[model samples]
Target: MIHTHEVVNQPPPREGVDEFATDAPLVEAVARWGRAGAVPPLSEVGVHVGSAAFQRDAELANTHPPVLRSHDRWGVRVDEVEYDDAYHRILGAAVGAGAHTSAWADPGAGANVDRAAAFLLFAQVEPGHACPVSMTHAAVPVLELAASGLRDEWMPRLLSRAYEPELGGVGLETRPGAAPRPAQGGGRPRVAKRSALVGMAMTEKQGGSDVRANTTRAEPTGADDARGREFRLTGHKWFCSAPMSDAFLVLAQAQGGLSCFFVPRVLPDGSRNVFRIQRLKDKLGNRSNASSEVEFEGTTAWLVGEEGRGVAAIVQMVTRTRLDCVIGTAAGMRQSVAEAAWHVRHRSAFGSLLVDQPAMAAVVADLALESEAATVTAMRLARAYDDDADDAERAFRRLATAVSKFWICKRGPEHAYEALECLGGNGYTEAFPLARRYREQPLLAIWEGSGNVIALDVLRVLDREPDAFDAFFDVVGEAAGGHAAFDLALAEAQSIVREVSADAAGAPVRARELAERLALLLQASLLVQHSPAAVADAFARSRLEGDGGTLYGALPPGVDTAAILARA
Candidate 1:
């Protein structure tokens, strides 16, 4: 008798792939350029992130998005966002692995690269919680610019590996003498927790990226004690992410100008600050995290730096977060490629495995190429951050960060879509990871800055920082002599940079084109210098030599499909 309900031709679940080991590109990239001793920790974290339990948590977190509790039953205005246990677990795991504070905890050669690798690995498990993690990591540098007293008090807490989620409930007023204060003999103020997470409140209703148009005001509270100058912030923030964070880096108009302030959830008196989470955004993605509209009515804050220098003070944090965006996108791409490749290798169609089919092989190889390029570029940027003493590296990063941010992020959604297609119907369903990956891919491009905003930032660097522009070309130029295709691409990129620099007024019109070319050239150059010969040859021939088409799977003949898929 024939079986009526046979599950025929279905591939087994793509489990047990060592996320670090199988990711030849990421593993090789880290080992080659990242810190010499960083692999063991990274490998351990990679194993955890790729485990079945972690993947299940990722699915549960996204499936059960955070719920906003604007008020208690008695209308107490609690404004607490409640997330599922999975969210907390994943976040705790990430924190425990030092994804947030590793660089600060161990400041040495390749420290940033190690941190970046950890971040990329953790983000592969879940992207939502990475928001606060990224912000908290980035906030350390900005917080350093604060008064010495404030820095001393907060740095230890921020660098702690512990993950604390307790929130001092609203309306539970703190008794006057209960809150921490300086010791009787004028010692530093005490902190309440072992670890703390930082969030960001920027971009208002009227002004998106035009932060200069912000109308929120910060009024000095007359107190001049050593605990740092007190201020009462009164304004509405249109986009405040991770509202439950211990403190936030907010921007507000001060007497001097727009300045950065550290606003806490609970005031020094142990009473809840006047931070009102108006409403949580129903975003397209990043559901595991909370992004809210917040109101600050006399909320207590401390100036991070001199008033009117908010932009300068927060620029470094923004740069760091932008790097996370690049890494996040690269991580998503890597997952997509791995999933797609696994499916094709195991699942058969007609008389052969999908991976053996010419059409399917081409698609998987193309995706692998994109993912490898993105990984290399992102890791290179991280390596640049590691060597702060090198002015040329610093300058190169200044320009390349913006360039990679624009191109890599913009390519994520398309790459994810192509990879998802390789699985056909299974990839389109929520049961498969690709559907979620597809949704999460766009957030990176839209988060820190939109595509155009990032491209313009690249242009701004070229026009203002001549050294940075030259530094960018210098790095890309090193790989010029190796490949003719790269040589041609580099020459064209230089020409465009010159043309755009000469005509600042017309630069905006060609910003995206220029950014794309520069990004492609940079990726090609890096691949030429570091990637496997097959991978580098394919990237150069397709991306650099104009042999590619608008769609994926357009890699020309003669490409090493098996070698590329093996890496994937």
Candidate 2:
């Protein structure tokens, strides 16, 4: 129920941090949301902030235990706590704030070499706390240094070992040849990013980014531009990561394999190489960041990894980005919640304090609960990333990433909106933080990976030979077998998944929904079959990034995505 209609906005008190503030529409709106009488739901503002399913997931996320307050140590505000630990650690922790994993390097991170084997095996320890951006920047030193140290003969091959961190934000901005540039720019300053991003990720496009169904092709070329060079890139690249990159990692189906061709720019020796960015996309959230719809008509290229290994290679790159997005999403949510909560504590309304209101109190509590839940899921996934993580554990890590991403991305805004209502008319205004939070929430689901993708990852676990699944759950079941009811529920949930899978008659539509349900049941089964205290305890220990996907450059066990040659 929206309260905007009943409450008119009141400007903020122009004094301190509220010094440059304006209306208090959000505070009044939330006050009205809790009040007895209600007017009409505002035409423009509507959020299913009251969704039970959503709220439930959020509640679970916050159940994890708290970690050492790393914010002060890391220099991040309270809002960015979830992303403080490389990849999935902070994410899983945010889900339930418990244990962690130790998976934050690629094949060549500057970590100790002898530790490489141990790093691969150390499923219980993760990288030191660092932001997603830092994590991504990490590869820079490793790759660049490796590239730099080369005897000038093997530089090209070393890029094969280079681990590029994919930072996927709706509108991520940065300038060319710059690192962590500025935060505020000269022109339109709303993006709040100083770096004029050279490579912006415009995630909104074609089939909404379904990699499997992607049609953008890179066929072999037979001609040259004004000045000649024999190379191939014969299709439109809908979403090129670095359209402006001097060299783009283009994924295309070649004669023999699905390959990533590192298309190098024609050296100005009268050579022709143009990845003409038809037009840059105009996105909603990360506006200052640029993403383009590119036409790679006859571009030049060279293969990076093996041919037909395109899908696997892309997945490798995607996996890196996927974790980064989770970290970034958590950071965004953290920012919104902190800002609104801080405002609520100081403001007064209806002759009492903002935090004092029963309505306000309940909503804030709910918001905190969601943040906590997301934190745990993310951390668990990070820890499970080591090279030695068994197949079952790895599947859980994938499922964990999806669960954390889906839940937080879905719920973060709900908290912001509720907090906005608490702020009243002022919150609705651009002057306050709630409105920005409101606009930013949609990007989380849409970015990194979408709700559908994450859900499917979870469903894949159940669909695997049930025993393979049980192989992991067996451990839990053995330890927790003392609880009769819990065991029964788990068995029953497995039955449900089997029943659903059996009935799926090769239909995509039915299969998708069923997959989501299978995952939902598994998650719910955890609740019924286990004691809340135990679940919470297990969750709290997941604050580290030492889980399944932690190993640098290795697939979790049984990820039998072994390349089957794609026939032409």
Candidate 3:
């Protein structure tokens, strides 16, 4: 065999490094907010996620994608979605690491922080599987609020670390083409030992964000059992991610008004529910996960919370999912900056190494600043979710979650693009990771709620929950005088808040602006409090003071790019 040319000046593959220990910002944030003992386990997760084998699996999962099998060869209605084996392994690793339910299962000091760190590590490697993972994690709170029987039956299965992709005996009707009886489990149902995942189906074709506009109707089954009020759902869900999940938190119209329901794929009687997959959506990214449009024909469902309180019940799930969106976005940013830094350190141009070059260093350092800010902010939010959180902490999360979701997710695509450009043509190709990241970044912004939806939600918090708004300001106020640039930015953000508070009607027009300023102030505050002096200083001058230009690499002249790049 003759080689066409010996490859030279190309950077080596970036893998096998411990993602957790090497991450200074994540480590510092975790120690400050999360339990000190959590670091050892998180380090183990870092090893697996950063390994070459895991990275290969991630690549294979996306490349093969998932196939929807609506029926078997015998023409029997199967309604199954087949996935690549790599996908299963990836999910298995994540679940085994307690990334899904550690917070709820082992509640203690900084439980959410530990789980969030583990989630960030895994998601940095493969984000497609994170959807099902995120949904399952968010499902705990909603299930807790459910009837005792429902919670008791499902919590054990959900909290299990074992990952079983198959529905197994959890499907409906052994008799071929027989109708499914929604619920008929006598006393305590025989639950499986396998781990279970939850999904969400809220948006319909007619109404996207407006769940009240949903036309799906829930008819009473006239059975008031241990699992709360039983109802039959007959409707079409426009977008249902992870169709193979064990159950879904669905929204439909009840006698009172729009309400939330827990719809399981398999009835308690060991038969499949009437869950039909219309078709899998062809999305721009997140191909490894199956997102489908489903139709429920007399589907068995148990009501969660109360009548006419669907939005209120599901808001808990939405809130957690939105937090994951911020964490996921931060993870992607971390991957981007890390990959860019790794590339520049090895590759050379014009007889000089890329990292040693001023221009390349500035760009990578700028990317690092964004990643650090995001990581710190995400960990702080996770801290708020801890079981020991006081009223002030709870209040802070209510408003801060929306702010971070709107800004960090909005910054994801642009951040990925800049990082992709660092590797020239290599980053643009599917053979590399950045191409996938570019596509993956946008989904976080769209998931849970889009930019406008989140912005308005922030305004709603300000208008309705005065305590939450006050809590947010108090948390950010800790770093008010830490830096001159940050102080000015904080003052300006407060002014904007006052103006928005004064004119509620005009607030809608300034919602985006308000969200941006709040997000920036939050990030800057976290950085000033926790991050190194150089990183915080650069961020304040570049982002808050408007000293930087529109694109990346626009740091101020005196900023310490070396110190920032050191972390990268």
Candidate 4:
């Protein structure tokens, strides 16, 4: 439902949405899922460590024949509440932008989150279906955040979100030698209270992807009125992707270090005080998924943990989101490309069906390769998450979360563009959903944590586990040893990292990019050698660099670069 960071420059897709018809089947699928039943009671929502539970929510109580179900706490009574109106409007925007725009997602594990978002949308608009599922419990910290930014004098609502029939149920992926315990003890929300029900809250500012150095601040606030519970946040948040949601699980620095807390936009006394939505800036892709520039003016808040533990509290949210973004974006492109290919097989061109054209065939082949590689990589990360975090859920909470998120989120969009190109001009236009799919994938890569930050996560981990780093590098060394072209490029990239890291005044950005590129190269090697969807080395590089190589001539001529790169 969120657009990645890379899409900031384009007009939001919602701005122009009258050009196409919604797929009846898709809408029906959403309706069918909605009408089937509510997911389950809060206690029953499955909580695992690794795998996803991308299934239909059981069903909710019917209020309006068509109503926004999960908007509140699986249907909080928002009608009497007085909060900023922005949150309510965002839902309509998301759907409007979706029409005629290429921002649609396909059915795939990678896009499990998008599917969940869509179900929410369906619940929102459905007339008779008044109830919604419990993504709120999944997204508690986020809901807390939204409520915080609002008023200063209302009783806190202890919401209970449906827990059963999770979309892609949970599991863990812990790492070895993790800290023994989280100081918060049992602060992590229950499965039914997870942040998902409220949508997700992600932060990956442009200049500070390295989350540890984030500039936001969280300070303790003494209570005011009896109902004015006290806490304070002062910082400049660049992007709250779902700006209109019930909550935002924000990260800010405190006396100890980086930590996170839940914030809301409304106070119980019917006020929109602490925070204000700056702008729903026009963006390149997921136009409906609004991102905002928000300034916290000593916002009243509640601390989720010790002052310095904001990062720790929020890391759980970010990591899970990061990995999920990958799945969502990649699934989007898979659906888009498959849709495009299906069109090509039947649509006629100059002389015959487009599939008959050799140029189109080659692009299809590339999409196939990229999709398979992304899928396998995503599954690997997911499974690893389940295994590693099996028992040590206490500390290794973000282990599987960070790894899978880092890889999948960035990679989903990378290949989404490749899939987009399979259709020429049709892909570029709102005439098809390719553009939207391309735009949506990057929401993962740049949000949560940009590709660079995630790469650094790997670097930080590897820095400590030199043996692990060595194992990875040894393979990289062997793979690139003979390929002079790859060797030179990679070595050159490494040298750039060394030089950047060597600088002190302002070298982090460059250093981060180098780290990201390094990670991509490492994964590329891993995929090439072992992945079933392993792309040809030269072909991938050609696409990466926009080099006019062998596949260039083989590919369809009209594919857009923006579209192609968007997939990656």
Candidate 5:
């Protein structure tokens, strides 16, 4: 019986290897983006994230989804979300690695690139924990802009790498003489290993992306101090993720209009706020992280930004989160490709190794090409986020982020599905990562904004910010002479842009088309400029030439599948 039950022809667990070191594309992208110094630390992060221990935590965290403990024993209203220790361990590791606020903390050359790379490595293994990490990172710019006094009081704590799991245990106290330092060893230590994670609550059931339609109300408390004007918010939030987060940046209708507010979980007095956790969302995926519907009944809050300018206030955060969506999706693709490649290399079928088979090779190589394109585009966007970036870089980021976010995120689910098929039945089971990945990928597309919302945003930028459009072309134009297919694609994109720009009223109908072309051209341009001829040529032929199939494994004839697979 034991002999008959023996297992064979399976791939070894993908662990212990450094995720950053193995990913040539990511390493090269980091170096090219001016983060050469970050490689060592990033490699360490890679090793930690890719280890078997980390993978176990990821599995456990999701298996035991977060539980919303709305009340304590004796019926005390706690409004708490209880997570498995695995979730805390994963979140702590990510925070301790400075994946959240390293860019803002360091604020110099390659800071954002470094953070983005680290984020990708962590998200690759466990995307559920990345929600709070990303929200925490995005909240920094908004805090700096809307509430200087609150920023002074909270920024240090927010930037701390320590993951404080206890919501009300640590007081909102900043250690004396503590300031943001460079990202060397978690960017300097604080009084203790204490930090805060931030969350956001914007969309209501009535208005998913249309935040303006929110009916939450905020009444003035007639108390103005260093923390800005105070308010008492009373409304229900339909979707508030990371319910365990120490604070949240929320939008509500104030006397003037919709305004931004900072609502802390625990007051300065060390007591919990009036946050009632209605229930946790039974999400399809991302189970480890708690997304909730909460009722804020006369919750003590402080105004952030101006009254009636909530949308304007959180714009920076929204942009940053959108960029993270691209990074997260790219990481998912990388994981999918790596898992598929590993399986194909080890699991022989029929007469030969799957990788050596022409059909299978084409699929793996195509997946690799897609992954590389997404990785390169994500890194390039991160590079443009440097504090000292030139005007052109900034303009490029403004338009390109939306473009990549729309196309790359939308492509994630299909990419995951294709990769999952490479492993046959094993991929469909929870025992494998691809099944989780397939479910996780769709959330990224819906996270920041869905396809339509983002497409319209591209149009908005084109209409309002002409520099952004030109800047996007300027970057793409650099690879103008590299390939005939790319050149033709670029020309086609320009023609479409002209058509969309010519008819403002009709632009929304063609927004998806415009976004898809711009995204492909951008990916093609980056591949041509930075990637190998094999990778670039294959991508341009299959993607830019419009000869590729709707599914993977259909690279044009004569394309070097081996070269692309080598990168994978």
Candidate 6:
């Protein structure tokens, strides 16, 4: 019998990009920013993360979301969360690659940049698991404020590269070389472990971003010693992600005011703390990770910092996580562009490859420009963290983090949608990764803080730290020498700043617009300073000069679509 059915016109799979070897932009960004030494390890990590096996694991983890076991077979309230094997394997790979604790393990010039690059690459494979990794990394700074005795007891275990998912129960032994330390008042010692993960529980139902409005109460247990003061917390966390983590940095009202506390899952007597996981959140994406609504009824916790300074103690951690938000969004953009570019290059239409068509090329080039700008901006911010000791750099970071996080994350969902359209119907299905990426993009913008919160933060920095405004202009001015469009945009931003400074009441109303301008000017300045002639000129003309339309692929006539797409 003659064959009547065939699968013709179907594009070949867009695999074999050698995510590590073929990423020219990532390679260039690392080397140009003084992270050349980290190239070898980062390259290996990229390859592993991009491998078929690891990608399979990433999909499996998301498909099989974590399950909440409220009780065991005997009906005891355990509140344990069980995850798929793929979730553990991916997290283990991230921990083993030092993506979580690399900066702390080796503090030097390019350590933060190196770790940021590695994190960006790993996040491309699986962003859901990145929550715990980011929390663990950001938790280090907060933990340092604890008493030396408390710090010494937990820091070593947190720094471990191993991923331990086991929760301490009856007869769980302490790790080797670490002795069980007694709780305050010489109570039975807590079981010390070789590896641990950290999480955050903020934003109660009544107060989402207004953590000051939280109603959770933390009362002293009346047991104090050199180790630390103990407290019993009673509250409900509206959104507590990674509930299986060993410990959480929570905010609760104390006698003085809102205070930071370290709430652990396992108590000193090798018994589970009074953490009641009401239910796991049914999120839109990030299914591989579990976010829970927890109720704490006299949960055992120790004060992390002084009372009435909870925001101050946790602000640094928030800053670090916000930085990750930028990095994660940039990774999403890169993945979207890569998938779009691959599809167009392989698929043919109208007697030619889609990539060769002028209209399609314009769209691909525009997407590439967005991706490159985001990559460079994120790397610059990472470099800023490396020089925190410098007053000017610190000031620059204070303002720049808010601006970049506001723009880059907000742009992610739209960019992902445009890239998905490039694949036609195939991209809309779960069979492709772009659909998942589109859903994941919005979470980053909403995770650390939403649009208004970030924009208002920019105004806050301007009002509180005037030096940061100067520092921001100083950095952008370095790249403004020759580009007329960038210079004009910079001057416009200065004028807005001056006007906003003159009228304090109107600043809140204009915060989002001002934040967008500041971010665009900064991104244009970075491209002008470091990117290629085609990329820089196109971005400056289209974005800074306001010569482009609202949608993607609307670059003006002089823009070099071929060169930009080639770089992408």
Error of 5 at 325 (Å): 0.3
RMSD of each: 4.1, 18.1, 3.9, 14.7, 4.9, 3.3
| Stretch of 10 with least lDDT, candidate 5 | 182-191
Tens digit of per-residue lDDT, candidate 6, span 1-568: 6666966667776544456556666777788774557888887887888777888888899889999998766566778899999999999999988888888877777778888888888888688999999999999999998877668777877788987787643224556786655433333345556788999998899999999999999999888765499999999999997999998999999999999998888875676789999999999998899999999999998898788899999987899999999999988998899889988988899999999999999999999999989988998898888844499999999999999999999999999999999999999998888888988999999999999999999999988999999999999999967588889999999999999988999999999988999999889988898888899999888887764468899888889999998887
Q: TM-score each candidate.
A: 0.95, 0.54, 0.95, 0.53, 0.95, 0.95
Candidate 2 root-mean-square deviation in Å: 18.1
lDDT of 1 at 83: 91
Instruction: Judging by lDDT, tell me the better candidate of 3 and 4.
Output: 3
> Candidate 6, residue 71: CA error in Å?
0.7
Check candidate 3 and list the clashing pairs: 171-271, 171-272, 172-271, 172-272, 173-271, 260-310
Best-first order by lDDT: 3, 5, 6, 1, 4, 2
| Candidate 3: residue 256 Cα off by (Å) | 0.8
For each predicted model, how many residue pairs clash, with residues at least 3 apart or on different chains?
A: 0, 97, 6, 106, 0, 0
lDDT of 2 by residue, 319-392 (tens): 54455555444444444445556666677788876666655554454444334344333333444544556777
Least accurate stretch of 10 residues (summed lDDT) in model 3? 182-191
Show where candidate 2 strays beyond 4 Å: 1-231, 241-247, 264-273, 387-391, 464-468, 471-492, 506-568
Model 3, span 339-449: residue lDDT tens: 999999999999999999999999999999999999999999999998899999999999999999999999999999999999999999999999999999999999999
Tens-place lDDT per residue, model 1, 1-568, is 7898988788887665568777887887888777787788887888888888889999999999988887666555656788999999999988988889888888877788888888988887689999999999999999999888778767887898998786532223345666554322222233456678889998999999999999999999988565578899998999998998888999999999999998878665545667898888898888888899999988889998889999999897999999999999999998898888888888998999999999999999999999999999998998888745399999999989998999999999999999998889999999998998898999999988999999989888887898998898999989978888889888888888889988989999999999999899899999999988899999999997764467888887899988888788
CA-lDDT, candidates in order: 0.86, 0.39, 0.91, 0.42, 0.90, 0.87
- Clash pairs of candidate 1? none
Model 2, global lDDT:
0.39
Report model 4's TM-score to 2 decimal places: 0.53
Residue 16: error of model 5 in Å?
Answer: 1.4
In angstroms, what RMSD does candidate 6 have relative to the true structure?
3.3
Instruction: Judging by lDDT, tell me the better candidate of 2 and 4.
Output: 4
lDDT computed for candidate 3: 0.91
